[model samples]
Target chain A: MISKKKVIAVGAIALAAVLTVSGCTSRTDSSSGGSTAAAGAGDAKITVAFVPKLQGIPYFEAMNAGGKKAAEELGITWLYQGPTTADAAAQADIVRSYIQQNVSALIVAPNDPDSMAPLLKEAADKGIKVLTADTDAPDSVREVFVNQASVEGIGEALTDQLMTAMGGKGKYAIVSCGETAANLNAWIAVQKAYTASKYPDATLVNVVYAGEDQAAATSMATDLMNANPDLTGLVGECTSSAPGVAQAVKDAGKTGTVFTDGLGTPQSMAPYLKDGSSSASILWDVQNLGYLAAWAGDQLATGKTLAATNDVNADLKGIAYDSSSKVLLLGDPLVITKDNVDTFSY
Target chain B: MTLDERTKPAPQSGRPAGSSTATAKRILPLPVTGQEFVLIGVLIVLWILLGIFTPAFLTPNSIQPLLVSVAPIALIGVGMTFIIITAGIDVSVGGAIMLCAVIVAKTMVSVDIPLIGAVALAIVVGLVLGVVNGVLIAYGRVAAIIITFGTANIFQFLALRVFGSSTVNGIPSTLEVFGRGEAGRTLGVPNSFAIMIVIAAVAWWYLRHASGGRHLFAIGGNANAARLVGIKVQPRLLVAYALTGALVGLGACFILASGTATLDQSVGSGKELQVIAAVVIGGTSILGGRGSVIGTVLGAILVQTVTSGVTQLGWPSQLANLFVGIFIIIAVGTDLLRERARRKA
Candidate 1:
């Protein structure tokens, strides 16, 4: 008979082995090597990794859902993986992990556009079709970018909303999540330039940061509203800032007078929309972005060059790409207002 | 040494009571008390240096950020110091913060729970997570580090599932007041600073004078000895972790209330390292039995000042991290060397 200690040791070793094997298999299934191709000539099995800035965000979740839908329709394997946190290094690690898995393509929304360039270049060197969506790394080695909407268009739209809310003339403020964020800065710059050219009556009083934190956004919004009582409109450049600004307005009892708008989930902005504390909000179909990203990866894996007006025949219609730049624009932004808020679904 | 004999003192009362009392004071010299004085001196010197280097560092606008940034960390560090003093570590405090913040935000938004009620619920969640850590460490005799590390991942995963990577906004008015409201300025000083000062004072008083505090040190110094003396080691250890958890929960209230309830997976990521570094640098022995709340606060300020100063200088933000890593190494290295020297002497 075996000693009790010896028997326990053996059992522990066996359990460890089982756990190790299960973990390895699950990891493999979630990543590349899981994709299988159809028999059709152009139906090459491609594994595309759709990496968002972070996981668990509604925006990115929607984008992933859309990507999954497109992937299913196009018969491509979609690897939806990202760091739980919005750290560039974490994102880079995920990219490197996917590359090691020998993924066919990578669609990334970089947390830091410039910082991720080197890693994207490395992926490109390995023959992976690298693309960016929602956010772009212009200097990166990615072949294409599936921009949701033009930065200029977003800026112009925001400025237009601000001007309209302010009744064409008042000192307004902007609450940005990060000063260094390329997209937010781009929007701010465009809005500034547009204000200079188009809406000269509107003056931007200040642009403060909440450091991409929800509480900080709320506090900063409160500070901004309190500091600029004459401020007719507040535009939040980050998703966290919208509800924060609305809450501030509601608390201050200036809801009808001081209108707010920004990029955020309808679920988050629902109360504000209902109460007329906020005018409108804009965001892209994130799930569709993820879906398209996977579809685009499969197309590239099959060696199909993305052409202008190619109509890749996916659930999302009006798909177009610029071959020279290898950039894909994922249609237009969906604006949700009180009138059509019910129609908009995540 | 026999316990009966160790408890008995030699009956050599030749000297006068006043002289003997003075001699007794001189011999022991309050090791921990002297250490705090040195820490304060160092902090003052650093503050002066910062003021000289960056004129704006002393101003309200520049200093407010530092205070706000350090408040959450300092709040968590207070409980952490107590836990560490008991020879236990809570790597899951960051997770506790996240968990608490998520629960509070969800309760506030989804259930429309009042701010205080939501906050209470968040604290309860924190207590539960902490209790799990305590049970694993105290009852199961599992390594505190290992237990907390596992719990950290579990809490993070749970937070992700609950919040779904989205920030929760529309915090109620009362919470916003707690997070950002300034108590009326007294002599041009912000109320937040006063609050921090008061907390530091209370923590210092408790750690220095309380009997429970003395027991914590005794248990940390030697758990076997503590148990032999019937000191209830396990329960104290459990309470330490539970207190840390509650403090982390309280810290989360301030952190979440000060910001929107957006669950950034990265919100408290890698913060455990920083908190540990601050505790160690504050002259708290990682091996336990000795620490000062005052030292931890100063250490927190030093770390935040360095971070904010580096950012203000417009250096690559990574440089701040590099500096912090180096500071931890040097501080801990000096502490170890000094400790070794003391033992040798």
Candidate 2:
């Protein structure tokens, strides 16, 4: 009787396992086998694969869209996939899988740049075109870095936009995500130095970390406002917190009295921008960033050196590639407001 | 465990030995446990300290939003307390929340669902998912943790498919009556908090006085013995889980009302841990058969208070996590001692 019961239990577990596996078939298809571009492996066309920080997020999906568009226009095969969570080891495994597949080019927006550095070196050793985009691993032996925007570009823009709403003077606090996020910290440093130099009247009261959780950001933003009742400005240092701070301002009925800005996607920030809670959203053309990464990958695979200022597309013109630092600039960061919010689909 | 005392064949007549004597003498009829007093004391001290340290911490502007944030976690904790008392768990609640919130949010966007309709839709969806969990664990004779964990992944997969690579933007404000706005409150009390209190009070009475609720304790204590006493253990267990699911549905709507106009896929990530943490810290014995809905509500409030207090005090966010971890360990330690004392007596 015990054995019979055990068998039934085992069968139920196995059934659930099958159900879950079938449900995640799409994610598995991409991460395990790359994209449909992998079907043309034997074809003569160059295959440039871009692995994002993670999958199923609007940010990386937008980048993937741009990569696919580039592949169609440039006549190259663009493959895109990444881990489901923003995890380092899982991401390393995905990168390793692409390496073993021996794709023509592998571009990674590494979740952990240090751990990914060795993998990039190994891929470069295998003669696979290696490039980093959206983020960078400066110490790695990569051919080029497709930067979304410079730290100065993002930081100064955030400050300028918030200052515009705060009228260049008043106390503000920053609700940043991931205290140890290297990129966020870099941009914050720039915001501080630029604000001190340019908007000297504005005082940064405090900077708190709320992680990637939107609700936490909202509550923290509320706390910040309560902490500093006279505070007139706030900065949500990541996509999650961008809408979060704006929501807090609105919920507290401080929309007109206080202001918020952040690195938010157009769609997420549209309501806030329209309601006058958020002054502006600072972001780059994510699709164009993806296109540039794929374009750079193809250039490297075909042994072509990029011009200092290359015209990749009509929408993306005079893309600057600095050989000395191996950084390709996607020009100034695009400031998103209610006027242009509907223009971008994502 | 009073193992020797309860093993005397339950007297063949009077209340199944441990069911009455064990619950009444040691636990019930007191309305509140010793653990609850300690929890209340800790909350009082923390609030007083926070009020002193951060002057704004005691103000209405700060406390109102903090309670608004606490409403959902506390609301869900009421149901989680019932499930945990039955010695079963539903770790899939986070994934369940994600699925329910996205569905309700989508429906509201496409069809302009009213407040009652949106809430009704969420509860029904949550009920269906809960039923799936109930049937599998009760009938299949599987461990609750393993079953719920598996269902957790499946639920997330379905939710993400519904999301389809984009966030649900421009969600209508129809659900904002439960939000932190003026519409969400009545006579300075947030409607969501008031509603959670009413439900938790009902749950409290049902668990304390109702025969069906007492049967849950019996089942959690010993399923075989409860079955011998004609307690219908499987159905009681099923109700525990299904109840949690319905609460998860209501809680998801509360989460929606509190957030911004957009709902992302991260709507309910890591919430299971938070809910379980609230349950565990509420002095709910993981071993089963002992807990209170009131304690669980207080646990949720205490946890949110710690988080908001940290921010208001301008302390590092990691400190809030540290305090919560410490509270969990201490609560568990005290529960262990009490269980040992009960066994010896």
Candidate 3:
């Protein structure tokens, strides 16, 4: 007699086999295989790929949208791809895959810039143009960097905003996304120095690391608040920390009392803004950064001579390309408040 | 098996003779297993020490969120217990969770589906993924770890495809009942934690009393022998994986509710390892034929408590893993010492 276990097992196996076959048949006909971005083909249109630190977050997604716009305007193939997690090894694999594919140019925001330096150099040696955007790989042999404002400017503005919200004189805490994150460390260093010089009365009580988990961030934020009941401000130093800090403030019923702000996306912070749990979020125009990077990539691909003092394309008029550093600078920070949060969708 | 019995072969093997079966079959109500008691003792000591040191660690505000986080890991531990009991493992649960969570999150975004519908879809998706793992391992007769590893990649690929390059934003709060919000609680206890207890209790009963459940232990003990005794070994193996998949679906909802409205692509990263650790720490033999869902639940609780305690103590978050590694060694070491003592007795 066929046992009960056999029936369920055999039945499940049959069902799975059927699903696999069906999954193969119904696969989407996209240009890129596992990669999300596709090329809009035109004759002599060079394909340039933009690899982000990770996928499926608002920040990089906004960047990809900007790249797509640039690709459409410039008539080039925009390949946007990266690992789903912020893992350096996985990112190296993606870079290797791109190298093997031999795309015209490569733009990347490296998760581990030092480790990716050799791979970036390899791509550049093969006559494939290389550039770093959003987060620079200064050690790598990349052609240029597309920076979104100066690091000092962002840190000073972020600390200034938090200090103003705290009324310039109370204990506060800072929650960063991860300790090993390169960009966050740079910003926090500047923030600490700025705080020391500018807001003498405000004491930075805690600096906690959340490790990219929103749940953990919320817990740490709550713990920080509870441990120091007299704290006046909470600064979330990354996109994931803002909501988590806001949620903690809201959960503790200290919305109006404990002011919160961070570097976060508009969509993630809208609810917090409306509820008064957070006052403002400081971020640069990420889409503009992506656009400038893709434009620079196209310039490199078409064999156009990009001089140190050359005027940027008409579509991107205001951005300046520094010849000495090869850095294309996007403008100042865009502060998102309750009144203007609706203005920015991403 | 008796606490002191070691030389006696497993009763499921049917080679232990009649007297051995009689001795092993002595009625003992489920109050405490050896590993479980040790885990409970350790947890109590840890909690007391944390409370004495931290002062705030004993409060509800500190404890409630910790329990809320534990709910999903323990819930998935139920299925993992079954899988391990059959001498099998499913490392693709993390990938399976991502697939279920993303699909459910996307559905909540596009069409305002009811909570029940959302949950059913998650479970069904998980079951399908489970079936994939089951078929390959059982029918193809491949090692469970290797097969699940391959399927993990496929499931992750499927989940990323569903993500479509952007985070699923503005997820409706249909899953708030399982979240850390006020709505997720009943009598100051999180509903997710309560549900996990109920499920674990049911699983405990089934694993102990049901004939079908005993068949799983037989298969794990010796698949060839199980087949000779008219037990369907392949089917039992398949069921273990499918059950884990179903739990992954429900567990994903707990995960979804536990987070912000924005569901990122890193939803279920590193979860499979956590579940396996809990099961192993619960004293379940990796070689199979012995385990309890109750122990798995307690193991999950113990793990979460250590994490919460460390953070509350104002220590570096990185130090929590060092403690967890030490606990795993201690738990396994104790088990090994006990096994040796039982053999000598």
What's the TM-score of chain A alone for every prediction?
Answer: 0.85, 0.91, 0.85
Q: Tell me the tens digit of each residue's lDDT in model 3 across A122-213.
A: 99988889999988889889988988988898888888888888888888888898788778889888988888888899888778888777
Q: Give the per-residue lDDT of model 1 (tens digit) for B1-345.
A: 221221122212223443657645422214344345555776678668767765455666456545665777776788889888887788888777877877777677677677668668867887888888988989998657667767887787788777765656554544654444342235544444455568767877777767677778888787789889888888888888887787677677767655543344445656677688778778787767878777787778778776666544434445666877886776666666655655665
In model 1, the Cα lDDT at residue B301 comes to 78
Could you estimate the TM-score for every candidate? 0.70, 0.92, 0.86
Question: TM-score winner among the candidates?
Answer: 2
lDDT of 2 by residue, B1-345 (tens): 222233222333334543756555533445776567778988999999998888688888988898898888888888888888887888899999999999999999899678899999999999998888988888887877778887988899899889988889889999888998888899988989999999999999999889898998888777788999999888888888888899999999999999888898889999998998888898888778888888888898899999998888888888989999998988777777766766776
Candidate 3 per-residue C-alpha lDDT over B174-246 given as tens digits, one digit per residue, 9 for 90 to 100: 9989877788889999999999999999888888888778888888777889999999888888888998999
Q: Which 10-residue window of candidate 2 chain A scores lowest in summed lDDT?
A: A18-27
lDDT of 1 by residue, A83-170 (tens): 6657776677677777776678888999989888988888889888888888888888887888788788788878787677778887
Any runs in candidate 3 off by more than 4 Å, and if so which? A1-47, A75-77, A84-104, A299-317, A320-324, B1-30, B336-345
Q: DockQ scores for all the models shown?
A: 0.14, 0.48, 0.23
Superposed model 2: Cα runs more than 4 Å off: A1-27, A31-35, B1-27
